[model samples]
Each structure stands twice: as C-alpha cells, then as structure tokens.
Target: MDIQTLAARVDEIWAGEEAADARELVKQALDLLNSGAIRVAERVGGEWTVNEWVKKAVLLHFRYSDNREMTAGPIEWFDKVALKTNWREAKVRSVPTAIARYGSFIEEGAVLMPCYINIGARVGAGTMIDTWSTVGSCAQVGKNCHISGGVGIGGVLEPLQASPVIIEDDVFFGARGEAAEGVIIEEGAVLAMGCYVAGSTKIYSVPEGRELPPGRIPARSVCVPGALASRDGSHQTYAIIIKKYRDERTDARTALTSILREGI
Candidate 1:
C-alpha cells in the first residue's frame, strides 16, 4: 500500500475504527521506517513536522508483536522489536555493541560505537554516535554531527504529540552532555562537556545578556554549563550559558578529524 493508505489504516486502527488484521499494516509502516523511506518526524519548509500516524504504527506494532530471542555475535536479547542488521548494505559503520532498533534509520557514512539507538531515531549521514551514548526514540540527529561519549539524547513515546529532541547539522555534543525533553540544538552548536539542557532549563546568552527561550540552543553557539543565583541568593540553579557563536578557533577545537571518519 502507498504511504497515504498505510497512514490512514494506522490511524483508523489507532482510533479503534479498523477491525482488520493490523500486523501487516504495522509491519509495512515499520519496514518503511527501517528503510528510511518515512520518518517519525522530518523538517518540512523549515519546520519539523511530526508524523503522528507513523508513531502510532510503532506503538501498535508493539501491541501486535511478541518478544523473541535475538542475537548478534555472542550477545543475546529478548525484545518486542528486532535489531537492525544491514549495516554493510546501508553503508553505515557500526562498531561492537552498537544496537539500533528496527524502526530507527542510520544514514550512509554514519558511525556507531557501542551505542544504543532506540526505535524511531535518525542518525544522519557522516555523523558519529560515540561510545555509551543513547539516542532515544524519535530523536532527530543531523548530518555530520558528533554525539560524544556518554551523552544522552532523550526520546519520548508517550503523550503522542511530544516532540523529539532535535540536533541539527554539524553539532558537537561534548562528552556526558544531555539534551532532553524536545530540545533543539541548532546547526554548528558546540556543547561543552557535562552540559545538560531540558525543556525548562534556563539558557543564558552571555553576549546578549539575556535568557533565550528554553530548550533551544542557538545556531553555531558555544555552550557551557553554568548556574544562576536564586532570588534569595541561597544557591545557584543549573543553566546553560552560550559563550559565543562558533568561529575559526571554535571550529578548530571541535573539528572531527577526517582520519577518524576515513573508512566510514
């Protein structure tokens, strides 16, 4: 079936309007997602559009499918979703212990190292998901991005309409950094080590001397973890401070060496 028909079927099933067998429809939608033909979300006309039907299909699939034993090398798993296994054909370079669920898409030239990428996540071309990083469901990672070691890119499946974390192109997320709750890290942003930002986290721009809207790290920004004084001056609350926009010096410091990505 075409995307439109598939979407309609899934939506009907979601609304308790379809009595037909849903397994095939759900599988078809998941197959499309696995092949990168459709995404949980996509940028359309400069805005990210959430495909609710696609997400519904994912949830429905969980209901329709049963847990099964799956193995890669000596490791084993029992889960409702199957792991992706077409790395060579997809032109993705995945190192040991890298696990991506069936519905996620890893574009060509991306490298995965000991990472866990949940269903509905997208790792863009030429990007590197470093060791111990977790890319949550429906999170959108852009091209040439560096998700550093131990970073947490949160995902959401509940409340159906909640936005996924969005990391735009050429971003350098430092080690142990965390971006959750639908945060949008704009293009070329360089987050310092250990920085954390959530939907309600205060983001202060030092140059502008003002607080930016929450959950958005501005384009080409250099972000560092900081704190602000409380009203009573008793303690400081965690915040992300934008030191400056990326420049030659910043680029030099955050540049991903070509040598590391040569094979990918």
Candidate 2:
C-alpha cells in the first residue's frame, strides 16, 4: 500500500470501534517499519512525527494498551519496526543482558552498562548509559552523550502533554547526579558530580549574570553552586548549571569559590 493509504488505514483502525483490531493494525505497521518503508521524524519544534505504516502500527499498540504490563511483545515489535539506520554501526556494551522496558528506544551505537532504561524513554545514538543509571519514561536523550553512573534522568509521563526531561547532544552527566521534572538541558550541557536538580530548583548563573527561576535552565549558561534559604536558616543545598564545560574554571570548586567571593 502507498504511504497515504497506509496512514489512512492506521487512522481508521485507531478510530475503529473494535479494540482487538486496533492492535492488529499496529502489528501491520510494525512490519512496514522493519522493512525500512517508514520513518519517525523528530521535528525541531519537539514533535515526533511517524511517516511509516510500521511506526504508526507500533504507536497504536502503545497508544491503546496498558503500559503497566511487562510484556516482551512491545519490545519485540519496536525492535522489528523502529529505524535501525545510523544506529546499525553503533556498539552495545553487553547485548542480551541490558534490560529495556516497554516502549523504550535504544538506538545503535548506544551502550547500556547494566542500567535500567524504562518505558517511554528514548536514548539517541552513541550515548553510553552507565551502570545503575535510570532513564525515566518519556525522557528524550540526544546523540553522542554520556550518562554517567548512578544518574537519574527523571520522566514525566503523567498529564500526557507534560514535558519530560530533555537532554540534548554531546552532554555529559556526572555520577549520582539527578535531573527531574520537565527540565530541558540544551546541547553540549554538563551536570557536575553528585548534583541534584529538580523542576523547582532555581539555577543561578554567574556567567549570564542572572538567576533562573524554577522550571527553566538557559542554554550554554554556566550554573554554579549556591545555597537556597532553608527553613532553619542554617544551611542550603548545592545548585548547579546544566550545560557543557566551556572553560577550565566551570567546575564545582570554581563555582563555589566564585559564589563565596562574590557573596551571591
């Protein structure tokens, strides 16, 4: 069938009254994906548009099914349909040993080191997910990045349209670092070792000369350590910037020293 005809058929199946047939339609779509007849487009505006009958099929499968059930069917379906190009040459650290939950996508050249990549999470090409790291549901990671050991990339799947943690290309996350709740880390960003960044955490910048309020961290900006006002007024938690190292002094020690000297 032609692409347009297939898309129409998929829409019809999804909108059909019967639920069982919808799942079957998804299976047909997967067949198309496996054959390289379709593609999933990641638009600049942050939309993933599927153009192949197979992607439509896989999407429909997840769209109508219960995500809580741990089934090999979904994973097998994706493995058969999702684009394997650009990732075909990618190296996997330990194949057949890495565990990926339902609806998760691990591209070629991406290495999983005994990590848990959960449902709805997508790891881009050449990205290394270190030991014990968690990529939450719907979290989108870009290409050529390094997710260090024990890091948690939070997922926001509830409320449907709510944004998930977005990490762009060439970024590096330190061990035991945490990023949660719709946080957007632009291209080439870096999170220091052991830093914990939440949605409500304010990211203070010394380079941009401004303080980023909750829920947003500017691109290419350096975030240094700072203390937030606690209830007891005794101490505060460390803050960090979510970007790549642009200079030699962008490390945690430099950030702390700068903050103390500047009294910010």
Candidate 3:
C-alpha cells in the first residue's frame, strides 16, 4: 500500500488495538527510512519541511513493538527496538558499544564511537559521532562533520509535526555541547565546548551585541558560551558568536585551533 493510505489508517486506528495492516504499513515506512529511501525532514527550496506522516509511522511502530530481550555476544539488551547491523556491507565504522537503532541511516565512511543513534536519524558520509554522544530521532546530521564526545544532536517524535535538528556539512560540535529542539547548525560552523543552543536559547554577537534568530546559526560562525541579562537584569547563559570567517577551504583542525587561540 502507498504511504498516504498507511498514514490515513494510522490517523484512524492510532492508540487503539493493533491491526496487522497498520503494523505492516508502519514496518514498510520504517524500512523506507532505514534504506534511506525517505527521510523525516529535508531542505526543500531552502526551507526545512517536516514529514509528519513519517513521524506518525515511527510512533505507531513503537506501539506495535513490545519489549523483548536481545543478546550481542556477552551483552544483553531489553528493548522494543532492534539494533542496526551489517556495517561491513554498508561501509560504516560502527565501533563497539555504538548502538544504532533500526530505521536510522549511517552513510559510508561514517564512524560511530560508542554513540547512540535513535530511529529516523541520519548520519552523513565521513562524519564522526564521538564517544557517548547521541543522535536523536529524526535528526539530520550532514557530511564530513565532527560531533565531539558527549555531544547531543536532539531528536523529536512528539508534537509529531515538529522538525528535528539539522546539522549542516563540516560542523565541528565541541565536546559535551548540547543542541536540541530543531536547532540548525549551518555549514562549516564551530561550536566551542559546553555550548548549549536550542530554540529558546539566545544567540548574540559580541561587541555588536546583535541578536540572531534562535535555533539557527549562520555558516562559518565560531560560537562560544557567554552570559546575557534577562528583562529583570539577571545574568543567563547564551551562545556567543565570537567570529565568522569566509575561508571554507581552511584546515578544520587548524581553523578551530586559531579560533580558540585568538578567542576572536
């Protein structure tokens, strides 16, 4: 059956008894997402569009799946979702302790270092998800990026129509930084350590004190942590755009070091 028909069924029969047809449709939809034939969100005409129907299918699948026990060598897991496999065939370097659930896409040359990638997420080519990090459901991480240790790329399944986070190509998310709630890190941006950016988090430029749109950073921006005052004059944390540069071809490691050394 077509995805449209499946979506309609999900709308009618959701949260009720499990129907075989509904489960079948959900499985097919998940398979499409797993195969990278479809995505939960994508940039079209320079705008990010949320595919609500796809999200509904993912949610419905959870209802259909019951908790079960799974074993991997000496390790055992109790969960509703199945872990992703066949990394050798897919050309992905999923290290030990990396847990990627079914229905996520990890492209070729990507290396996952003890990370957790939830359903509907996509990790692009040559990207690295460092130790203990998470790529949340439906989040789209772009190519050749370095998501450093303990970083979180947020996911969204509730408010089913909401768009997930989008990290563009070549972004360097520093260690332990957290980004969530549909935040978009534009191409080639560098986020310094412990930065927290979300839809409500203020992002401002230093010296100029200009406020930028929340949840979206411009390309090539180097961001660090800072403090800003609320209406009551209480100091609160915000992301500071310390610098924005134009050299896209610069060495990422050297460029990041320069930004750190100059603190510019």
Against the reference, the lDDT scores of all candidates come to 0.91, 0.60, 0.81
Residue 174, model 2, lDDT: 70
Question: Tens digit of lDDT per residue, candidate 3, span 41-84?
Answer: 88899888877777877888898788999997998889888888
What is the descending lDDT order? 1, 3, 2
Q: What TM-score should be assigned to candidate 1? A: 0.96
Residue 46 lDDT in candidate 3: 83
Better of 1 and 3 by TM-score: 1
Lowest lDDT sum, 10 consecutive residues, model 3, at 255-264
- Candidate 1 residue lDDT tens string, 117-153: 9999999998999999999998999999999999999
Cα-based lDDT at residue 5, candidate 3: 74
Scored by Cα lDDT, where does model 2 land? 0.60
- Tell me how many residue pairs clash in candidate 3: 0
Q: Which candidate leads in lDDT?
A: 1
Candidate 1 total steric clashes: 0
Q: What's the best-to-worst order under TM-score?
A: 1, 3, 2
- TM-scores of the models, in the given order? 0.96, 0.64, 0.87
